[model samples]
Target: MTARLDSVEPAVRDPIRIDFEGWSIEARAGETVAATLTAHGIRGLRATRTGADRGVFCGMGVCQDCLVEVDGVPNQRACMTSIDRPLRVRRQRHGQALAAEVTALPPATAESLRTERPDVLVIGAGPGGLSAAIAARRAGAAVVVVDERRYPGGQYFKPLAVDGEDVAPPDAQHREGLALVRRALEAGVEIRTGVMVWGAFAPAEFTASDDRGAVRYLPKAAIVATGAYERGWPVPGWQLPGVMTTGAAQTLWRTARRLPGRRVLIAGNGPLNLQLAAELLAGGAEVAAVVESARPGARHLGALVAMAAAAPSLVRDGIRYHWQRMTRGVPMIDGMVVAAIERTAEGLAVTLKNASENGGHRRFEVDALCIGYGFEPSNELLRALGCRHDFDAEQNRLVTRRDGDGRTSVAGVYALGDCTAMGGARVAAADGAVAGYAAAAELGLPLAPALEREREAAKKQGDRHRRFQRALWTLYRAPPYRIEQASDDTIICRCEEVCFGDARAALAEGVIAAGPLKRATRIGMGPCQGRYCRPLLEALLAQGSDRQPDEHSGFAPRVPVKPIAIRDLASASD
Candidate 1:
């Protein structure tokens, strides 16, 4: 478990008592259930169907690991739900079982659902969505942006605590995100937070719901900037209570001013890991080590030149982060990976394996282990809308297909940001501005002359960001993933707890595609909707043989793309 950092100023001192299990814990007003529990030295919030202890693994609402029964409502995300008053929370063991047979759709009366018509609707409240809304509204189009999070900034710009508005801006990124949010609000962009866009119908019709009620949006144009979630690689005991993605830990510190643990070990294959390590160090955590799979030294000097040339500030930040570890005497274990994690009496024992042929190993005992391999686009909405996509071999994932201005195969639909491709925040913002202008133009909204110039400028800026990302990836090159490296007993499908052996057996049955394999084993039927395992399941197809992704390689997204309450479904209005 973790504790609040004393260095970080308190957001608000108003404390509320929440009864978890039988213990009454004091939590700051407006703090999430996850943060409150963590601050009070409680991490394990639930038990999987198989009775494995689970906690906040993804930190976001995506993973569903932090499901806690809040005031009797089961399956509430601890990280997303705040405690504004005294409450009784419980560690959820299992959900209520559903009936065996399907029945008719629930009746959703018009009076219960709130509906609206807008010139443009933007999904997600990340940089891309906010930029799109600002641009579209500036171009004289009525805009509405919906996000599942409680705040405007996405993962990149994790907002201050809900009651932390009075706190000083922590960094330039925070200031920039706040400025962008302000700009969007000033432009009259209607942003609805804490609302989940659960389903999308044809011709850009969308349905969303929050705690109060559901909303249906009919728009002339809709921009999808749902962004992406980090890819969690499966290893032995990876589903332990204290293990989570690096971003999850970072979000806890950034927004709630709490460390995952006093001692933390981070293992990953991207610059984000380094950024997290640096942030944790600054936030008063004992970073045992940073296990990076990439070797970036003399072998990558050539790539560094191009990176510095393209984005000098970002390169400088990387160098600073690299040095911070050195001066602090934190071991920056290069060319190594986290092979496995096992729970110990105190915390966790992590095994680090070398990426080279020498096969050296190291181990560390820490309170938390953070794993962040890479990312996969959160494309459920895009897929449910029937937008076209293509498999990107470099990233080893299916990326949504979009044109220069983020237009998709569907006439009125658009996608951008990490959802369409793995471009960083600036790249996504630039792309979003261009898409917003394009959508406004199509809607016959009054276009400003300044917008055309800004759009062109954004295009050029995006080109630079892309070049920098390419160079950055080159500098931090990762070895190809081989599922054979993992133990046969390692759980592949985290939600279902399906093992690698189980998948191999299904493969032996001649099930090569995603759909049949999903049926053969209940792999993709879990709450995460296979976000953690589907790619790895697909990777099983090319385990030894170099198989490629066919048109049917990926799983199809159905309605209620994300799990939503049936009550919410029955009460939606437009």
Candidate 2:
């Protein structure tokens, strides 16, 4: 029921048949293995070591939950691996040994490493990273932007279809990204999409890899705008197939034009859930219910006024989303949260409990469950590069300590977008431009007076968006996060399958910080590098200690923040 609003309906071009689990499935060129599987109702992609069913939880490459076997190569992330030809994809099961398979694989080669010297290195192709690159390039710096995503727009500016070359962008976000990316390219910015920036040794020393091999970047200055991932809530059966973050569902729908299921139950805190619900409904998917943790009402009139003042179009968009929900007869279950989820023959049986004044529980049998509880910044590279950070008690996450112009504590290094703070795309774009101009000025690059004037405008735009973000959150404010509500048996780490009880026992044994607790219980030892569980672990610690976790409570940023092939890592050595 979920697909692009293009010729995808009638038929597609250059289609290929994939032998997935002995069933021949139709797929499109450039379509992700995850999308191809889900389009035909193939949910259970793999099994956890504990025999628990898993699917596309994070959607992006952050979570390794969607690993599958691709042509005998076990543990390939279906979401990250795209196929343009015929292939065999198998479900990776529990206790499936890769030792023999590993030996069968090809070895690493030094030729995989390509050294590049650039004036500015932007570690993301998203709004912020592209903006920085564009500005730096225009100011006479040789800029190279690297992003892990196949498309250059990053998550917010995600392209409409996997094979949408003939199709126009479905929305204004993609259009905007297209325009910005075009401007960056015109300004001589070297954008290397499909490249994963894995490690940062020095301020501007970075190692990245692609399908072919690895590349080492030595830039004079660097901007770490790796962006953020969807924050997760650890509910029971959350790891089940068809249960995923709102962003993951959006990615599938937007990029691959595939819905997780025919009917979806969208839940959790923040405006994203609402926006996603509207998008899915527009895409012809039946929304079972929009379970929101917040109850926006007239009591937040001041915030509404500020939001309208800051971004009237966005406010109107929010209204439009609600109007669509109403017109579509979609249930907008506000002041509630997904309490539990269980598998059903038809789909998933979801239980919604009241988190606010709406004191009631509702049940729904839906094909999929989309849960997005805001986001956590992907600041591993920034932190790894020794940029300072602080715990924002209000937001309940760690934020990068940076100047107004995006200057980090380390010289020649910058940060922008939600990676620094969870401001929206508008905020990121505006702030990125300012940082770019600042970087240019610092590098002694010639900045025309017109560009300086535009920089001032960018600063103003950033201010307005910041104000809008504040007011928007106020309008969508939810109750405090209660990690204790999660059952003791709830799995906290999807990678390691560590449960709440395990962490509780570890805390009982005198481990309070993330590092010690991670070792004691092996919680954050997952492939995601604690991007999903770090906040939960800190919350768990706070619940037990009766105090909030400090900035240090999050795991220390390590080398190869994202999972890199051993071959790619070895090739990084000059």
List per-prediction Cα lDDT, in the order shown.
Answer: 0.83, 0.82
Going through the candidates in the order shown, the clash numbers are 3, 0
**lDDT of model number 1:** 0.83
Candidate 1 per-residue lDDT, tens place, 451-498, comes to 889988988989999998998899888786667776789998888889
Model 2 RMSD in angstroms: 3.9
The lDDT leader among the candidates is 1
What is the clash tally of candidate 2?
Answer: 0
Off by over 4 Å in 1: 1-13, 95-106, 109-113, 162-169, 356-358, 544-546, 572-574
TM-score for candidate 1, please give it. 0.94
Instruction: Name the weakest run of 10 consecutive residues (lDDT summed) in model 1.
Output: 1-10
